[model samples]
Target: MSSPLKRSLSTTGRSISPPPLQRKIPRLTEHVSSTREPSVDQLRIFSWNVNGVGPLLQKQLSFSADSLSPLRTFLKRHHWPQFLCLQEVKISSKDTATQRRLQAAANQSAAGDEPSYTIEFSLPRDKYNATGFGGKVHGVATLIRDDFGSRLRATRRPDWDLEGRVLVHELDMGLVVINGYWVNGTSNPYRDPETGQVVGTRHDHKLRFHQWMLDEALRLERSGLHVILIGDMNIARARIDGHPNLRTSPVQHVKNRADFNAKFFTYENGLSAVDVFRHKHGNRQKYTYHPRGRNWGESCDRVDLIVVSRSLVDPLDAVAETDILDNALDRGHSDHVPLWVALDMSIFSAKAAQSGSD
Candidate 1:
């Protein structure tokens, strides 16, 4: 009935400036002198599995305030995002020898017009507590393009180190960015230790993660803040999202069998779910995760993602799609392929309201 209010809509996505590009070795540039506004719309973002950023640092990457190589190049050339999120950083000390090695990688890759990105990382400060369902420790970082950093800003959440799997960076773009990495495989692993039977280890893990995932989701829901939950959730969306599973793998989380504890998480059509990637060009495949073997790989599941709130999707009228970026250089980019992204959040909010009433 009333005209919708026009507030600043922060375009949410990472700058190569986000931690991923930075931990690789964010080049520190001389502060450019300028009085200008940062671009908010038409944002760019990237998510990838860097294996472990630790080993590379040990090589040529230096940890000092000085700039490094390939890493700097990678960020410079690729520093397009208002923000960036990187997985598997192998977080170590600020003075660790590995920093130099990582710098070397950056030194070699720096290029292009992206010298504006200021890189930062989310390295763990305490011992990883694997005592939970998932193992402890890993790196998550954020990068800010010079404009975004000067115009907008970014910071990691204080609570993330406990899990060390997710990175929450609030960007100047106005949206709170949650860059995440759900545990690969289950923690309640192995068949019943005493039964000597091969139990459905993955099934047990699904339940655990589902609870964790939903708990996290509800927190977002309660905040009523604009949010984006992107990263590797580990659960295959094909088996859970909008489709029905004709076959159920004879597996279940040993601790909590019924995963959709309706009390904790949200589900679509009897399955836990989240939307991944947006499709404008339309050649999305069914698989996102892959097996080590090529032929007969795990083509049946969809895992890696760029998920947002159900509320955001409804209003934004956002469409979903997935691209499988599997290449030789990607051999060790984690067990899953990188997912391409496209989103139109501006149109989602209105659509979301209309859909909810019906």
Candidate 2:
């Protein structure tokens, strides 16, 4: 069999200057679509924790005068992906300035024409509700190439979705893709104000997020939809996934790791999906997140991931390629590097054909 095709951009001796913070953010209107159609047999999906869209857009505009839109520049930098998933967008629906900026950036073409991407946003609502991140801290967005996006529909649960942490979309082809920014439990133990009792609000949220995600995936599976789950899971997941190994001494941290293993990775009773990237790379020490102010490689974790249901596993050798984009680190785009997976479209298309024949 042929080797898995590598489409990652080279990160060799090239230098990209740090974007000037003072540069005036350029206004970008519509232009010709920068994205091209993928091979009929292949589909590509990309995910990144942009840190924040507002700042990322400014950096993109600073790169070149010709940059028409953030999506355009982004697609050009990496070969265009059919689906682009972003986390930690940090834009709230109430923040009109940033909201408008994001809208402008996403609409990368003439106003009268169809935009290149069909964008979906899970933004924090305007108020500080218990279920939300107070309209600022966390958000997620997904941009599907218009053709596929047009054929998709949203799936949501009020509690899991209100914080703008989860965005689920189902395609007409019986596939569901979940883009998530799982809760990162607090660094310190929490205490109730009045009673002074330990109350792990953030930690509880993290566990709930995991359970919710597992339930959603299972539900989709029972409905006969294949699932592709992607984004910053916030858990380094294993000793091998982190430099110097991640701390498991904390009871909460240990619980978190165990929970993830049981619900998602365990063979006997878990979701039984494959962490496709890891399956392909097989113990390679590459990482996706390097905490700010920390030394790269020396202090990092591979928290970003791409996972797919069991049905998709057999096609891996012939149809899939996964990569952690090191070049994104060179550009200083965000603390998290872009992670991508390419799958042959024929896998899905064949299933569709079979169903029709049945």
Q: Which candidate ranks first by lDDT, i.e. highest?
A: 2
TM-score, per-candidate, Cα-based: 0.58, 0.79
In candidate 2, position 146 carries an lDDT of 74
Kindly list the per-residue Cα lDDT of model 1 for residues 19-130, writing each as its tens digit.
2223333223445221122234445555665545543343333534434443343344343445556665655545344544544454443446444455566554433232
Q: lDDT tens digits, residues 38-99, model 2?
A: 56567788888876665555424655566456556666556557788888776766676766
Cα-lDDT of candidate 1: 0.45
Question: Cα deviation of 81 in candidate 1 (Å)?
Answer: 3.4
Off by over 4 Å in 1: 1-40, 54-79, 93-95, 99-112, 124-137, 151-154, 158-161, 185-213, 239-250, 253-274, 278-283, 293-301, 318-324, 329-334, 343-358
User: Which parts of model 2 have CA positions greater than 4 angstroms off?
Assistant: 1-38, 63-65, 107-115, 126-134, 155-158, 187-199, 315-319, 328-331
RMSD of 2: 8.6
- lDDT, each prediction: 0.45, 0.67
lDDT of model 2, residue 22: 36
lDDT of 2: 0.67
